[model samples]
Target: MSGRGRKIVWGLVLAFISFYAFLEHDVRGRFAARQSVEPAVIVPNKALAPVMAMGFHNLWADFSLLNAQVFFANPEYRGRIEKGMIFREMIELATTLDPSYKVAYFFGHFALSSYWNNWGVRQANEILKLGWKNNFDDYRFPQYIGFNYYLNSENKNEIVKWFRIALRYPEAPRRLIWTIDRMLRGADTTNHIHAESMCAMCEDAKEKEQKRYFCERCETYTALIALNDLRLAYLRDKGRPIGSLGDLTAAGYIDKIPVCPNGCNWLFTADGAITSSSLAESSTDVRGVP
Candidate 1:
């Protein structure tokens, strides 16, 4: 071809490339905006998911797991807890697609239970029950069920039932076994159970940093137990609840309000109950305490 003809062809090619790139960018931007405005929907029935995955079920499960993790980690989701959101559905779909995916079961229970309200606890229990049924040999599932029961339910009978199930598995952690024994004997408080679980998690930590972090959590929970005990004693003696940590200090409950090892302040609820910001499950309101 002649030089002018070649130059003209090259200019045409560049223009096409630029136009394609601009179109792609615009399409991506619009899609992202739509996603941001409209929250994710829950997956349909679990039975249909594997068929929809088209033989790449594990890959689809992994994608669902990733989406769940990101959704639970999002601050907006954490704050809102909106109904019909994909939080529970994604985890359920992931586990349904790959029942043997232990990480999905574990993370689903943890994230759901961390919501620390009745609805969240019920959802967490459902996930843990599925985990227990599917992964029977793995004691963590039943153990988490027992723990959630202890935390949220006043039904001692149900607590004992799940704890017995967990203890039947020899692979159950030593701390869990101990907690169960304590609960059975009426020697453990909720704080003690929380501390024991934290200590158990600390023992399982492979990294020095993780172990240290869990150890700190153990200390904080323990301290909160002591502070709560003091509050109870004050109520017994004065016939009224202590108003705040400052009240405890002024009344000689302690030299001062004990500092939380987690660096979050102990919060006083509307009922004058003391709780740490770090322990979401410890709220009296969520536990249905009068």
Candidate 2:
């Protein structure tokens, strides 16, 4: 086959794999519902990956990335990832086994930071940090690292100091480890820094596709940030929590609910927390709480 033919073949192969995985999950989810049992998900022990790799670490990393992509699409199962069952572990396994897996780092950044309520900032930054350590020449990773820090404004000084320390000693294992520790500890909620990052990525990213992706992600982030900010404002002004996401619009805080760039709908709770169905399964906790 020609080089172009080979590229096309691999593209189809990956698409097929992703589609099959999605279908299998869909069928299994329905079956599990009928059977009244939990969907069986097998996640590897990230720490034991080296032993299990048995000289196929690179291949294992690729598989981990695929799994990460599949799981990231279903926010319902994100709890599994958050509760230490899948999402975060897969990213770690992929990057640790194959530190140069650039896509995994990028994928992790978006997947981990899907929560506007600050659920995945720590995980996203950790992935970004790992990428920065291994692929320091990539300015995008460092730029994003700084952007994620903007979410947690109170710890700005400490994060700035340690983040710079990490930048200075990218190759030092001990220092990088400590800096990552510091970065994870101090985050609050999302803010409207999305526009800045979005604009910066548009100007700096070389690829058109990548620029578009960042554009959508930033728009989504701005929506979430607005939701978080106005959620409080509604509480203070109305003397109660929002009755629904529409309440924000009804109250004139935002004109409309921003559809997620990921193509999944976002969810709102009465208490004002923002979660993404595109990032996780639609939340049931919201209805139960009220």
TM-scores for every candidate against the unseen true structure: 0.51, 0.44
Task: Give the residue spans of candidate 2 off by over 4 A.
Answer: 1-31, 78-85, 158-290
- The most accurate candidate by lDDT is 1
Q: Which residue ranges in model 1 land beyond 4 Å of their true spot?
A: 1-45, 83-85, 181-290
lDDT of 1: 0.68
Model 2 lDDT tens row, 1-290: 99999999788666755643553344566589778886766566677777766666787688878877876776666644444335777788788889899998988887677642355776788788889889977756765666566564544544444444334433433334233323333243343333444444445444456556556655766666777778889989999987667787888988876666666566664335775553333354544221
Q: In model 1, how large is the Cα lDDT of residue 133?
A: 85
Q: Top TM-score: which candidate number?
A: 1
Question: Model 1: per-residue lDDT, tens digit, 1-290?
Answer: 99999999788666654543342234444466667754334455677877765566787678778867876776656634563145888888889989988899888878877764766777888888998788878877777887777667656556756765665565656566446544433434366665665566566655555567667777887787898899999999889887666667778888966777756667765566676765544444423221
State, as a TM-score between 0 and 1, how close model 1 is to the true structure.
0.51
